[model samples]
Target chain A: MSILVSNLSKLYGDAKAVNNISFEVHSGEILGFLGPNGAGKTTTMRIITCYLSPNAGSVKVEGRDIQTESFEVRKLVGYLPEQNPLYLDMNVLEYLEYAAQLQGVTKLMIPRRMKEMVDVCGLGEMKHKDIGQLSKGYRQRVGLAAAMIHDPRVLILDEPTSGLDPNQIVEIRSLIRNLGKQKTVVLSTHILPEVQATCNRVIIISRGKIVADGPIEDLQRNLHGGEKIILEVEVPGGQSFEMVSVQVRSIPAIETISLVEERDGVKKLSVETSNATDIRKDLFQLCVQKGWGLLELHREKTSLEEIFRQLTAH
Target chain B: MKFANIKYIFQKELRSFFNSPVAYIVIVVFLVILGWFFTSNLFIANISSMRTVFEMTPFLLLFFAPAVTMRLISEEKKSGTLELLITKPVREYEIITGKFLAAWALYFLTLMPTLVYYISISVIGKLDLGPVIGGYLGLMFVGAVFLAVSVFGSSITENQVVAFIVSFLIVFGLFMLDKVLFYLPSTLASTLEYISVDYHFSNIARGVIDSRDMIYYASSVGFSLFLGTVVLQKRRWS
Candidate 1:
């Protein structure tokens, strides 16, 4: 395992910030940490990065104990904290060189390492500019450059794309995806689409507890059960909404039918089934036998957002 | 244990000090005040000497040292950069010592200009070498103790003003303890007098380098730094 957290707990007075959380992150895996605000996602990331010690239990990076051998763990982990703090007084290149030095980069390697980071983080023109002068997107890029300057084995990012415009978010998301090819990345974001687009596996935390942990496909299938199918039908004559609802309820494997709309003798119905098995054929045959005109039929997979909401909802 | 990490942090802190107006302001203000005291006293006493300058430095340092050291750790805490530094491969003591050394180096730089006073005194007339050297060494001791206290204060709060105030109160308390000792019972007064920094500083300012005085200053630095390391570690615990 690249990272193993066993029975980790951190408490702030009576409230448990992270309660007996246990998980493992293997090498070369881009793991998404999903949670609501105050759900202990940042706390867990801090513990793994050795920024905060757990009140109980242990965390190991590359089989090194975080408490006893924190320096070794620190050498292996690169972290971009939640707000992406940087030395605003220093220029981008200066701050990266400082970070590189702390990471034990030899003096001769610093310029080469800095050049690589500037190119990768797209801090081309802004490398010589003071951090305080940069925009929020550019500052976050500087923060990422600092985190990746040492080129450690694992990267733990907390809300890396937060507070960014759409274009910036996509840019950073793809950058993270590219970096994941060589490093074990654990990033936390509530943006479900970002996780879906980038991470192959995810861990959803809720109220200091792990609600779900698995690959994308397994999580969708296990927690959400199945897919959502939408059908549009026009009766030969005007059919009331009640008729469609009653007819769709009788189909086996159909769990729920929500009426989306009904207008001009055309009705849109959203059908949910119990498993991964497709029930569109059964619905189509039923519509055909009933002499109902099937205008459109398509399957909408349950989105990660819906699964996240269902798992984290109180 | 890692010299490179310490050097990096030390250089960063030193650079940050000079990047803003704080370094120039503090150094200028310090020299101006010290210069005023030295020139005015020399004219009044009609004596060509830096003896009074050395004697006046520790009391002056009680105020000026906090100004230089107040922002050292508190600014990092306020800006959230402390989190980044501590998570690096550097040890907690390395960060604290790096900051301490930087603040001390700046204090030494500010004090270095006062050597002109010494040079002028030597140029103008016969200057006693013993007290001048003792005074410089004593000033360093005072600076180290005050820097340690200020760093401890900075570690406890994110507000630089609060850090200055708390450190001022601490160094001031230690400085005034010798005077306050007379008000206590004789037995307790004697012990408190030994613990007072001014007691030891005055002994050194008189051109005597007692091992006891050196021990006192060393212990103060060690104790304050030990507390500072604990304060940094306490953040992880809390």
Candidate 2:
């Protein structure tokens, strides 16, 4: 495991900010951390990066305990905090060099390393400008460059694209994707589509606990209870919609059937069934025996958004 | 504990100080106050010595030093950059020392122009060099103590005003403790006098190089810095 967080808990007075959470992240994969606001996502990332200490458990980065071998762990992990904290008085290049030197990048390597980071983060025109003069989007780019300047192996970004415009969000999203090819990336965000677009694995945290963790596809398959099939059948002019709905609901595994629409002498039906059951073949055979022409049969699984809402809702 | 890291932080802080207009303004205000006292006393006492300048400067430092050091850590905390600084591989003490040295260095620079007072007095008449040297060294020690207190104050909060006020109050309390001791029992009075910064500063300012006075200033700075580090550590845990 590139990172192992076991039984980690943090308390703020009487409140449990992070309660008994455990998970592992491996090498060369993008892990999407999905959580609502105040769900301990940032708290967990802070602990993994060695910025905050846990009240009760241990975090190991590449087999080094974060509490005991924190300097070594800090050397291996790069973190972009939630707010993207930066010095407004310093120019982009100056701040990046400061961060690089503090991270222990050799003096001789700093210029080349900074150039690479500036190029990768696309801070071309803004590198010489004071950070206070840059737009929020550009400042975020500067923050990213600072995090990656020393080229740590693991990157932990808490809401890396939180406040960017739509265009900037896409740019940063693709940038994160490219960076993930070589580094283990863990990013937390409320944007579910971005997770689908970028991450291979997903961990949904809710109220200080892990509700779901697995490959995205597996999560969408397993955590969600069922799939829905949209069926369109050509109807004889004399048949009523009630008869078709009754027929579709008569199948053994079919849980519910709703009439979607009627057009061009065809009736559309939505069929719900338990997960892991393939009813399309059964429905096709049923259509042939019923002497109805099946025009369309499409399967739609539960979306990640719906699954997230279901898992996180009170 | 890395020199390279400390150098980077120190250079960054110095650049930050000079980049803003506040440092220039504070330095000018400091000089104006000192120059006024020197000239006003020069005409009244007709003394060519800068003894009056050294005598009055420590009280001015109660306010000037805090003004220079108030934003050191408070700005970092307010701007969220403190988190970035701590997550780096450098030790916490490196940051505290780097910033302390930078503020002290700036305070020394403000003291630099006052050397003209010594030069001009020497040109007119024979000057007492021993008290002049001792006075300046005492001022340096006093500045170190004030800057350390300001850093500690800054570490405890993210508000610059709060830092300034807290540092001012602590330094004021230390400066006034000798006066407050007169009302106490005689035995307790001497111990409180020993603990007061002004008492030791006065002993040095009168052309003395006592190790006792030196140890007082050193230990005060050391203790203040240790507390500042503990504050940062507490923040990390909380």
Candidate 3:
């Protein structure tokens, strides 16, 4: 594991910020940290990055313990905090140099690395501009460039795409994707699409606990115990809607059937199955025998949005 | 424990100080006030010594020290950059010491323009160089202690105005310690006088340069900076 966090817990007075959460990030994996606001995602990230020492348990980054060897761990971890903090009074290049030097980057590599960051973060136009003068999107870019300036192996970014426009968001997503090929990344965000677009694995935290953790596909596939089939059909003249519904309801595998729409003498029905079984063949045969014209048929898997809402709703 | 980190932080803070209007304003104001006090009696009585400026600086520093240090850590806290800063490979003491040195350097720079007072006095008359050098050293020593205390104050709060008031009160307390000697009993009065910042500054300003006074200034600066580091370490707990 590139980063190992085991049973880590942090308490703020009587409340818990991170409640015995444990997870790890492997080398060269982009892990999406998914949670709602105040879900302890940032708190956990702070602990892993050696900013906050855990009240219980421990964290190890690249074989170095965070509490005992935090300096070494900090040298290996590149963190862009949730707020995207930068010295607004300093220009982009100066701030980046400060960050690079603080991370222990060699003086010889700093200039070359700074150029790399500016190009990667698209900060060419605003390199010498004061950070306060830049737009919010541009400021966020500077924060990213500073975080990556030292070229550390582990990148922990919180809401890296926040305050970015559509074009910049895509650009940053691809940037993270490109970096994740060799570096371990733990990205935290409440935005779902960015995670789906950038991260290869995800861990959903809720109320200071890990509620969901897996690949996105596995998260979606495992949460759903049933499947949905949307069927558009043309019913024969003699068959009334009630009669056709009664016959369709007779199938044992079909759990529920609801009329989605009735337009231009055709009915669109949503059929829900009781298990992960193929019912499309059975439905098609029934439609043929019942003299119903099958216009469309396909299965709709549960989306990540639905899974996120389901796990965090209660 | 890295020396480079301290240098980086020092350079960054000092650069930001000059990049903004605050440093220039502080230096200009300090010079204007000191100039007024220095020249007020220069032509009237024809005194060529820098005695007036030296005597007036310790009291003036109660505000100057806090003004230079109010935003040292408080601005980082309010802007959330403190997290970014502390998470780097630097230790807490390095940051506190770096900022303390930067504020002290600004104090030194602010006092630089007053050299004209020393130069003009020496050129006109047989002015003593010993006390002038000692007085400058004494004022800088006092400035270092006050700036360290103000850093501690700034570390505890995220508001610059509150930081200014807190450090101003603390530095004012130090400034007024010897002045209020009559209010206490004999033994306590002696102890407070010995602990006061002005007692040591006065000893050095009179060209004494005693080891005891140097130790007092060094210990006070060290103790205040250590307290600032403690406050920073305690922040994660809150």
Candidate 4:
């Protein structure tokens, strides 16, 4: 089973909110939809969830055309909008039950399913409390619980962990990871760590188009394949600077070296290499031969933030 | 279109309306003002009929019905709940109807307390039950039409106040159209008056349950509600 979108375009007035973009998510995969604000992340999710229709495109869920068989698509998909979109007056159990009934769950299965969601989402404590009285984190859990109550095959969550504490964020991420084992999950968020923590694949969208789409590890490896090194040198005299610079440049693998800071006759240099090459050993040996005192040496990996910025800057 | 889904949505909307203070405030304010109008103007003035109450109802409905329906779709749009509601397996018409039915039911409840005016008129004088019942039916039919228009207005905007104002203008315009047509030539005025909602309502108010009048109000409501559904559909595309 899979979700396929081809040449999907949404135009609001003269502006194309979602340009001709396409991708697919297979069953039992967590696809991260990453984008900046107004980058059509929510719009794409809305179209997949049948909240909005695309102006030009075809959306197929499990090989069924969403335009012609929206009811069936909706039955298979559970959508959690960005704002949570819950009735604050309803308690957790009541809201879930309402969602279950709306999704065509049989009366007999409501109780069992409700219990399962309550337990899985950790809403047992807040099940009796009104949604408005619950904290933002608990409310987010309730939104997730509502989406899962009907046991749909696909789950689309928009910014699920937004406005949550770090602890709650981790807990929700773990819960999503557990869900990904069985359901095809599409999670949209601007928070990079949530995608790295939970999603198996990432689709980075920018300016209403897909910029990058692949497994997270592959994206990290392909986009930024390098181990950066930071070197702090304690020179006995000014003569050590010219020698260290000449020796560091002679190594063809070193991409660039920049002086970060120099104080008290100690110069800190940031050295970069192409692809996960370990230049720390090369730099250490060169420094020792030149009789230069090596104060500190470390390797730095390219962070997800840099990759996200590079992919979505346009 | 599922029965269970519609019922669930209906119950949820009802519970929400009751849980908030807005519904109670609206209902109480309607009853109090209607009660005062009936007692001070009709009873103390020694009028034996509900003519004064019925006469004042159309004007009262001009403001009150829109207030009841202004937030039905607008508030959902503002709060982003419309996305959640639409993503369910239920059809768009089901959501619209569920909210409309809830607001209509609340409006019907607000009308119930006014029945005391009917009873009081009957006790104090030899009441003409036919015209009074006819007037109440006309009031309800007109109110339903106004509610439909207000719901349509609410669906078009995210601001409840704007919805209220737009609906009020539409309802007031329809009410005044019949009188405004008098300045036109006889032939033109006759045709325009027939299309006016107030003209058909007055026909029903006078104890004449004309099929044409009933059809007019029914079609007005149906037409407005259909427009609301179309507006919502267009918004998705937009």
Compose the digit string of candidate 1's lDDT tens values, residues A1-314.
89999999999898999999899999999999999999999999999888888999999999999999998999888999989988899999999999999988778998999999999999999988999999999999999999999899999999999999999998998999999999999999988888898999999999999999999888877776677999999976776888778887777887888889888988999888877788888889989889999999999866788888899889
lDDT of each: 0.89, 0.90, 0.90, 0.86
Question: Clashing residue pairs, candidate 4?
Answer: A225-A275
Q: Given candidate 2, what's the lDDT at residue A111?
A: 99
Q: Positional deviation of B183 in candidate 4, in angstroms?
A: 2.0
DockQ of the two-chain complex in candidate 3:
0.82
User: Candidate 2 regions off by >4 Å?
Assistant: A232-240, A247-252, A261-268, A281-296
What DockQ values do the models have?
A: 0.80, 0.78, 0.82, 0.71
Prediction 2 global C-alpha lDDT: 0.90
- Per-residue error (Å), model 1, residue B35: 1.8
lDDT for each residue of candidate 3 in A113-188, tens digit (9 for 90 to 100): 9999998888998998999999988998898888888888999999998888998899889989999998999999
DockQ of 4: 0.71
What docking class should model 2 receive?
medium
lDDT of 1 by residue, B1-238 (tens): 8877778888999999999999998888878888898899998998877877777788788888789889888888998899999899988888888898899999898889999998988888888898888888998998899888888888888999999999999999998999888689999998899888888878888899999999988998888887888888888877
Model 4: how far residue B211 lies from native, Å: 1.4
Docking class of 1: high
Task: Please report how far candidate 4 places residue A38 from its true position, in Å.
Answer: 2.8
Chain B alone: TM-score in each candidate?
A: 0.96, 0.98, 0.98, 0.93
